[model samples]
Target: MLVFIDESGDPGFKVSKGSSPAFVLALVAFSDRAVSLEVQAAIDAVSKQLRVFPEFKFSKSRPEIRDAFFDAVLPFDFCIRAIAVQKERIQSGYLRSNKEAFYSFFVKSMLKFDNGLLKDARIVIDGSGERVFKQELSSYLRRHTEKGAIRSVRFSDSRNDRLVQLADMCTGAIARSYRDNRDDADRWRQMIKAKIEDVWDFR
Candidate 1:
């Protein structure tokens, strides 16, 4: 199994000052390697058709392009699991102030809630933090997750991994649903709703 992880919104708790009101982490899982390749090929085809960059980022792409990207990939075989956290609802100071801790907490939370779906899965998270931090995160996940369920954990640049980009798009769709400004939040979501296995709201 292959799992791609990505996030939307900042982990900072200063929602009133400048932080995002909600933080979202999404996991995209592919049970078959052939289906994974098919999805990558579809993304490549869509990017070429739209005359855009090879990498499709949810935050950077235009609304129409975003819609097109989702439309292109919805037919593939994969499952999405996401966790949307309302920052305001979190009262724990440690979780609120510590970015890495908060990230590790939610990432583990999402995987744990998956039951045994992630067993023996290889996880690729969007490369963000420093090397040591990534190492720590990997260790933390392996130590806490179901025994032998996680085969390996690694980091990859989203620009280089189309599946990670897909996770970003999925995370963006879920995060937008919690935003008051995005009136068309459900539009992209509805298009791919059947593929979304779970969306946990942390309230």
Candidate 2:
């Protein structure tokens, strides 16, 4: 199994200090590696068609570009399992005070509930943080998750990793859906509803 992970929102608890109310992590799994190439091609095509410079990001994309992106990759085979948490519901001080811990806990939670899709899977996450934290995250997932659920964990730059970009797009779509302020908040998720395995609202 091959998986790419990305998150749409920051893990900060300051909702009144410009922090996002909800933080989301999206796990995109492809059972067959070759099929991912097809999706990558579709993403590349859309990027070129829309003149999306550098890369595709859900927050930066135009309405038409977002719609076209979801439409372009709809026929592919993949499962999107995600977890979204509202900051107010979280009562743990450790998780709230430490951003990395908050990120790591939720990341492990996302994979722990895998529906038989994870086993010795090579997981890649959007590259962030320094080398030490990256290594710590890898070790943390291994120690916390079900045995053999993670074969390895790697961090990649989203600009170079197309599948990681896909995760970003999907994560963005999901996080947008949770924000009630936007008029078209529901629009993106509805476009890719078929591929979403579940959108768990973590309490």
Candidate 3:
């Protein structure tokens, strides 16, 4: 299946000292046809649960989203995974820099299932950090895929393709998860870790 991985928050590296609880990443997977329906349904559910529109602008006041959003989104026909890295973990060397840690987490988890989609998948990820995120992920997929080739995937804000917007929704979820449970940092980390490793295959 094609996966679109995106991150939310500052990855703890944004600010050196003050409450560095901003690093979070969510890895969302989708089959070709399932992307649109599955993502929108989950988003709509979250919006309804919160009584606030999902399209809340970045500059707008933050809205409280229910945890059910994450819980409900995971059981779709397509796979959905999230990783919420805390600043404390990174500062303590528990996790690498945000991008590198996400690369390791995503490639390792995603490469496990040898489905029809993985063999000829078109992975779409959000644009981040000089577009290095997309390029690095494409490279990892090439190295790991059976044919060593990832189909055409681009990273941009262009609404022509709906996956980009879906990815942003997933990113919002990850950020919300971290922001909601700032006191239970370890729990959040473990929850994220378990989800990512749940589908891991070493072969």
Instruction: Give lDDT per model, in order.
Output: 0.90, 0.92, 0.50
1-203, model 2: which lDDT tens digit per residue? 89999998899998898898889999899999899999899999988888887888899989998888888988899989999998899999999999999999999999988777798899999999989999999999999889988999999999998899999999999999988999999999988888899988997
User: Candidate 1 — which pairs collide?
Assistant: 120-149
Model 1 ranges off by over 4 Å = none
Question: Where does candidate 3 stray beyond 4 Å?
Answer: 12-22, 32-77, 91-119, 131-137, 144-152, 158-160, 180-203
TM-score of each: 0.97, 0.97, 0.53
| Candidate 3 residue lDDT tens string, 109-197 | 45434444354556666655556755766666666666743565556542333455444554554465445556643332343333343
Model 2 TM-score on a 0 to 1 scale: 0.97
Candidate 2: misplaced stretches above 4 Å?
none
- Model 1 scores worst on lDDT over the 10 consecutive residues at 179-188
lDDT of 1 by residue, 135-193 (tens): 99999998888887799999999888889999999888888887677778777777779
Model 2: pairs clashing at backbone N, Cα or C within 3 Å? none
Residue 38's lDDT within candidate 2 is 95
Question: Best candidate per lDDT, number?
Answer: 2
Top model number, TM-score:
2
